[model samples]
Structures are given as structure tokens and as C-alpha cells.
Target: MTQPPATPLPPPRERRRLRESKSLSQAQVAERVGVTRETVRSWEAGRSTPKGRKRTAYATFLASVEAEHAPAGTVAPPSLNSRSAGRHGSAPLTRSVEFVQPPVRTAEPVNCPHPTRPPKTAAEAFDRLYTHTAPALVRQTYLLTGRRTLARESVERAFQLAWQRWPEVAVDRDPAGWVRAAAHEYAMSPWHRLRPSHRRPEAPPADAADRALLDVLLSLPPAYRRTLLLYDGIGLGLPETAAETEATTPAAANRLLHAREAVAEKLPVLAKPERLHERLAELAGAEKLQAPKSTLVRTDGERRTRFWTRSAIAFTVLIIGTTALTLRTAPTRYEPVPAPGAVISGVPPQMGPGPLSQADKKLRATLRGSGRGGPHRLAPEAG
Candidate 1:
């Protein structure tokens, strides 16, 4: 007997149609692609595209994937390097570039060769030292010399000289003492020079008492003031004071005596020695000390750079202008003047304006004469 027609299976949905066309299935493709069943469900439902290596390998495992349900692909697997190379082209730089960059360098201090180098720094140092020392060296120098200006000038000169020789003086037993001695020598030396012409000392302000004291100090000779300040103001011993001022011990003592006597003459009668030494100390204490500062030194490279940069800019501009002028294609010419119409005005208009015109001026003169009868009879002088 013929069996009843076998039950026809219902056609697969579009997803199944595509899967059949590509020979894939939800389970098989999912298994082949190593994705979850839910992911395959989403793909079949058109929710997402299959991604990554599994998509590339999808086709390879079609048969196994069909048995187990998986994705399909025909292309060979893509390597990581190949993928990267494909994303960004394998190209080289277009030009050979050279960049000029500056390098960092350690700073070097410049030496002020002359003993008379700017005392501004030493003066500052003296100011600092003056505050700390029992007897300020700066003040003592001024008091000793009876010339505050000279004293400041001398000490600063000495310090600059000594600083330059720091290597030699560095190992000295007493650097500060050496500097002090050098200052004294500088003060008394015939070589003592004036400051640069470019820089002049400002005049000291003179109040009454200060004026009187300054007059007294200035009145004494340099020698007497030097001895007094070095011996008494500075409280230096006889031999040390003598050594500083370039005088013998006895000579230093004599000058010291003279300094005191000179000062005493200007003061009220006070028998106590404290009165004199204290006054001397005060003078020594009041002097100024300036702080040190860096000074400029000449350098060949700096000079060359400065010179060439300025010259190069000027030369470049000049060359460009010359080239532009040479390259100009047109030339200018002056045109000749034209004669005027009719008999012609006396002056050509092109020659520029003149008293309206000679003819016009002459006509105006005739009209004025005719209006006045005779030019104007001189007006009678007012009584």
C-alpha cells in the first residue's frame, strides 16, 4: 500500500535562507566562531555584524560549523602586522631636516684685572662686613684718610684687586686682614686714581653738625687721619697698624697722636680718653658697605654674533633693494613744456602760479589808479 504523502517540512525563514545559501547555522556558526548562542541569534536577527578573527575564519569551518552550527568565510586569516600595515601606509619622511638648537653651558666669573675695578661690589661687601665687625673697616678707612670719598674709593679698589688674586690670597692666613691691609696701602699709594670719567661721585649732603665734622676730618692731613683711624678707630696694634699704613711703628704712633689732637681741638673739653676713642669708633662705624654684583666681560663669540647679525640684516636689505631696482622693467622720462594759447600769458601755467597773471595785475593797477584819481593822496597826519 502507498504511504500517505510525507509531511512537508515548513520552509526555513530568511535568516535560515541566508544561512543555507552561505551554508551556515545559528548553532554551527556560533560554535565555529566561538561566540555564544545569543550572539548568533542576534546576528541572524540582523542585530549585528559578526566581527574580528572569527569572522575571517567563519568560512573555513563551514562544514564543521554546520555540524556544530557556526559562521563562514572564504578569505585566509589576517595577521596583526598586515592589518596594522593596511590601516597606515608604509611611507617614509619627505625631507632631510636639520634643526639648530642651543646647548646649556656653565657660567664663568670674570676677573676685574685692574685694582681700580668698580668698587661697587666690594663696597657692598664692606657694608655687610661693617655691620658685623666690632670696628667697621669702611668707616675706619674714611676716618684714617680724612677723606671719606677717597677712603671708599681706595677700599673698593683694593678688594677688587684681592678678589682677582683669590687663588693666591685664598690660602692666606687672614684673607680679611690681607684685604684690610691692601686697602690701607691703596689709600696711601701715589697710584690712587680717580673713578671712571663716565661715573662721578655724588656730592655728600652737608647738615650743620655733619658739615662741621666733615670739615674737621678734611682739615687734617691724610697721614694723620690714616694713623688715627688704623690705630685708634680700628683698634689695630702698633706693628699691625704700621704694616697696613706703610709706616714704621713709631711713625704710626706719632700720626695717631696728631689725629687725636686735631680732633680734640674741634670738640668740647672732655678729659676722658673714652670720649675720643668712642668718637673715632662712631665715625668708623657709620661708613657704607655695598653688596657685590656680577660685572660684564668682553667675549669674542658674543662680539662676532652681535656684529654679524646686525651687518647681515643691513646687507640683506641693501641687496634686496638693489636687486629690485635692477630688475625693474620700466623707466621714467620728463616731458617738454607746451606753449600757451593766444598771445600767451607772461608765465606759463605749468611753470606755476604767479601774481594771478601780469596782465591781470596790470589791469587791477589801472582800475585802482582810476578809482583813486591819483593813487591815494597821502592822508593828512593825525594831529
Candidate 2:
């Protein structure tokens, strides 16, 4: 495999010349280079060398400065120190350095403008989507789970999934809807049951009526709760709610109906549409403060790499676990030993089938019946 060439660093003397040619202060150069003024001074003073991207930027900047400051009708010097008895070098040329200072506006508020340009890449699109949709997704998740941390976790996981599938997600007709569905799934996951609940049992409401209504709403099933939130709290239609929850329109409507009935049983005030919307708004709006900042997601290729790495690790662990368990639980085999006196001196214990013939079997049976008598004499007395 071939390796790419590394970027070249500018000579120390060349760096000082570039700063001077541009009439830029060390502070300005430091800011542009994203380093401290002392670092830039060290580079220019030959005490240290610029490396990596910093060195490349220094070289590129110097080239541009030379191009801009070169005098007309005269070719610029190929190198900064190539001046021995040169015309301009011999002459005492003085250049005026202007120090432009502006009044400090520390007391004034700063307005950061958002980028309005269209995204040209999938990464840019993902960033834009995170910035715009993170708040709403978090709030929606909070409304479903009634837990701030869980809501943030769900939204983050959803965005992570979106990032892994950015190729599909970036081109989807309803990217936000796709993310919302993921968040909802995460918020209602059974995995949460395995973990001890560290979050608040329920969110505090704005008023008594809202509190009672919220208690009842949280008691309902996750699907019904989400349906109510999307349909009424956020003012989304049944079709959109169904799409977000991955349910049919009729299913969403049925859930909405049941959710309303459940709420009405606790607080009759919720039976009224206006009252219900008001309470729902209050319940959902309480979560606005808890919406978390959007997170960056790994790209599709990176996700694939991680997936394979995790799979390999899991397989190795599985093999190790199987071997350990087998070793621990396998039955042990024991060889049979003869009785202490059963073996005669210098004779091996008989392990084969014994007394196969009728006469031998009858003789063995007679010996077994002589348990209380002395060993039978070999001589046949009565027979």
C-alpha cells in the first residue's frame, strides 16, 4: 500500500518574514493559528518548530503573503534570506506599521448568526437536523417517559441511530419522523425495567388539576400516552401521530380514545376538549426545560466498523463462557475398583462377563447362597 506524503513545515526565519510582510502583529497571527502568542513567538524566534496542520497553515499563509506584498516590475526573492548586496536589501526601506485599535464592547450583547446555507454533505445535514430537531425530540421523549435523563438518553440514542443510517436518513421524506420513532422505541424499551429507576417517579405539574391529570396520563400504557402527546399536546394529526409511533391511523385513533377515557375516569374536567388540551399542554410543556443539546453521530462506515468489532468481542466472550461452563458442569467419570479381599495376590480383577454357561452360572448362584456358612468344600460329597 502507498502512503500519502506528509505536509512540509516552513523554516523558522520564513515564518518571521511572513508575519512582517503582512504587517500583522504576533497576537493576530496567534489567533489565526489557534494558539497562544507565546507559541507563535517561539516558532518565529527559532526556539520551537511548528508541526502538523499548524506547520502547513504557516507555510500556506506565508506563500499568500509573499504573493500579495511582492513589488511590481520586480520578481520576488525565491527565499527570505537570499539578500546579499541586493538592491532593496542595500537600501534602507522603511515600512510603516499601523496599529488599528477599536473600542471594547464588553457590555454589549453578542448575536451569533446561524448558518443559512444549504448543506452540501450528509454530515452537514445530520448536524443541521440535530440542531433543529433535538429539542422537540427530547421533549417528546420526556412526555412519554416522564423522566428527564431517560428522555435525553432516548433522544441521543435515536440521533446515534440516525447517524449510522445517514445515507438513508438524509434522503428520507420524513427524517424527523424516523428519529422520533426511534426515540419513542428507546423511551419504552424493556431494558429500562432491568435497571433500577434513578429518575423521578413523575414530573411535577403546574397546578392541582394538571397534577391529577398528569398522574392519570402516566398511568396509561406507553402507546396511549405517546398517542395523546402527539395528537393533542403537540397538535399533530392522527396520521402524523401514527407515522411517528409506527402504528396505523385507526390504531392511533383507538389509543387516543382509550387514553382520553382513562384520563376522564380520574378527572372529569379532562372530558372537555378545551380543558384536556390545556392540561396536556401544561404536562408536555413542563418538559421543555429538560430538552438536551443534540449530539454527533458516527458515520455509516464507522458504525459498520464498530459493529464488526463488537461482534468479534462478543463471539470470543461466548466461546470463553461456553468452555468455562462446560468445565464446571461436566460430569466426572470414575473407574470401578474391586473389594479389598476380592483380588487374589498377583491376580488382576475380573472385569469381563462371568459364568456364561448354565453349569458355571448354577455354581456361582450356589456360592452366593452360602453367605452364613463357611466357604464350600471343592469336593462333591452328596453329588
Candidate 3:
């Protein structure tokens, strides 16, 4: 004779109760099923009902658990709110259980150089580039300009320019290099040179000698100052420094060598490479330059709008002013008749029209004779 069929397992809630009653932790059950404890929790809480193999696995585990605790032929208790509980008129063995799925989580995409898709707009790309590079750029700029305000202004203005030309900037192989060069140019702008400094701010110094070294560094020509900063202050190689400053490797190396000599002449304490690097680091820290907030950087659309608006206004003003000037200074075809008294010729001035020809006089006589010298006539003769 065949054996009787196995009893069906109760719902998810009852299964959990049965497991807890048996003192089997969710971990043990999860390990048996090859899923996470959280997954097992989801199964038991009914937030996510298992399907196919997972369902089968869960039912089997629950059945085994129930069988192990309770004797054969005993019916497991109904789960909370299950139809079986109401049909059987059986009170819940325990208080009602509630199931809530943990909130579904989504990972935010990070902006990085190697993202699967490039940033949607040039502004996004530029901002990402700025976020990653601005601090180091400011530090380098501070080293070059020797003035905190000037360095900060240079970096900000360079970023603004970068935002304006983001399309070109976004695709650059070395976006930081481009920004560095731009900041350098801004730091050394003739406009900045023309303005005299009211007072020189003191550098952050290890001692008196560090301040003297910085002063000498600032006193060097812009080219030498920038080369030394990139090579030492920023720790770029000779070729990279050359590329940043738009100089050949040999020229950058030569400038760096001479810059070291100049610094040594001014401050004998920093003549050694190790000594110079330490002093540069001290200066970089003292400047305390920060990366500008991304929000402070305007988007590509805003920059484009401002540029086009200014261009249109300028073009309109130029056109209007040019028209006015052309009208004012333009040469005329004929000279004005001399003033009444100033007439050089003895003949009377021909103010209105020259005297009518003898033929014209005859024509007038004929028109009057024909009664055509009235306002209705088409010719002046009518008047």
C-alpha cells in the first residue's frame, strides 16, 4: 500500500513562527538556501514571496522545521489573516505579524572620467573636471602669483573661461593642464601687472628664511616663476611642466635651473632641491587656497546666453554709431550756395530756378490761352 501524502506547509508568517519556535536563526536557513539573510527575511516577512525553486526550497525547509518540532499527524497553526485561520475558527497562536518590504534602493551614478557615457552637457563635464582639479590648480596659482587674492581670482576667472568654452575643454586630453595654463595667463595678465600692489602679504614661513625665499620667487619673471612652481610646488615632471607652460622640455628645464639659481642667490638657505621643495610646501599650505564651489561655476547655457547677449548689444551699438558718424562726416556732392551778401558774382543769386527759356514763356502763353493754367493742370505752368 502507498504511504499518505505529505502535509502542506503553512503560509510565510506561520513558517517564520515555526522557525522561531524551533530556535533556527534566519542565518542558518539562509545558508541552507544559498541566499542572503535579508533575502530570507524578505521571504519570511512576505514582502517578497519566493518563486519556483526558492518557493520550493522555502516550503521544504519550513516543513522539515515543523516536522522536527511537532509530532507527525499534527496540523501546523494557521498564519495571521490567512483564509485557513478564519475557516477553521482557530485563534492565532501568536499576535498578528506585519510584513513591510525595505525601501527599494537605487545607486546614484558617479561622475568620473571613464563613465560609460560622457556627461550630458559640456557644463557637467567641466564642473566634474573642476571639482577634481581646482584645489591643486589654486595652490599652483598661489605659488606663481605670490598673492592669495590674485591667485584665487586667477583660478576663478580661468574656470569661468573654461565654462564658456566647455565643449572644447570637455574633450581635452588634459583638461587640468588647459586650466593650469589659463590660470597662469590670468595671473600674469598685463592688467594685473599695471596695478601696483598696496602691500605685500607675508608668506607662511618656517622662519625668516622661508619668507625671503618666497619674495625672491615672486621677484623672478613670470616664466621662471611658473616653471619653478609647476616643477617643485606642484610636483610635475620637466616635460609636464613644459607642456603646462607652453615651453619645450629643454626650455622648462633651463628655466627651472636658472630659477633655482636665482632663489639660491636671494636666499642661500634654499639653494638645495630638498630645501626648496620644503619651502614651496610651506608656502602652498600658508596660502590656504580652496577649490571653488561647483555651484559658483555657471553652466554652459548661462555663459552662452551672456556672451551672445553682449555680442548682439555690441553689434547693434556699433551699427548705430557707425551710421551716425557716416551721416555726420560724409562728403556731399554739391557745395552750398554762398550766403546772400557773400555772393562773389555780380549776377543775382539763382535762389529758386534759372529764368524760364523764351520757348517756355511761349508755352505758358499758349496754356493760358487754352484755359489750362488752373490747379487741374498736371504741369507747374498750371499754378
Regarding TM-score, does 1 or 3 come out ahead? 3
Order of candidate numbers by TM-score, starting with the best? 3, 2, 1
lDDT of 3 by residue, 1-383 (tens): 99554445466656665654453456677888778877876666566777666667878888777566443322222221121121112122111122111111111223443432456766556655665456556766777776777877788878888777877877676566677788889988867755667255544555665567667987998899887776655545565667768898778878988998999887888877756766775566555466556556565336766888999999999999999999999986877887665657788766877799999999998977878544654556654
- 1-383 in candidate 1: lDDT tens per residue? 99554322212222332343242335565676788866655544345555556545544444332333222211111111111111112122111111010110111222333322333454333322222221234555665455566666656665555555656655565555676777777777655435463155435424454445656766788777666555444444556556667787677767766766777788654223445555544444444533222131112224545788999999999999999987694456666689665655686556665567888989998987788665656778889
Best by the lDDT measure? 3
lDDT of 2 by residue, 116-135 (tens): 34566776566656654565
All candidates: TM-score: 0.37, 0.49, 0.51
Candidate 3 residue runs with Cα over 4 Å from true position = 1-120, 196-209, 299-308, 311-315, 321-383
Q: Once model 1 is optimally superposed onto the true structure by TM-score, how far is the C-alpha of residue 93 displaced, in angstroms?
A: 90
lDDT of candidate 2 vs native? 0.62
Which TM-score value belongs to model 3? 0.51
Task: Tell me how many clashing residue pairs each candidate has.
Answer: 18, 0, 0
Winner by TM-score? 3
Which stretch of 10 consecutive residues in model 2 shows the poorest summed lDDT? 100-109
State the C-alpha lDDT per candidate. 0.47, 0.62, 0.63
Residue 371 of model 1, lDDT score: 83
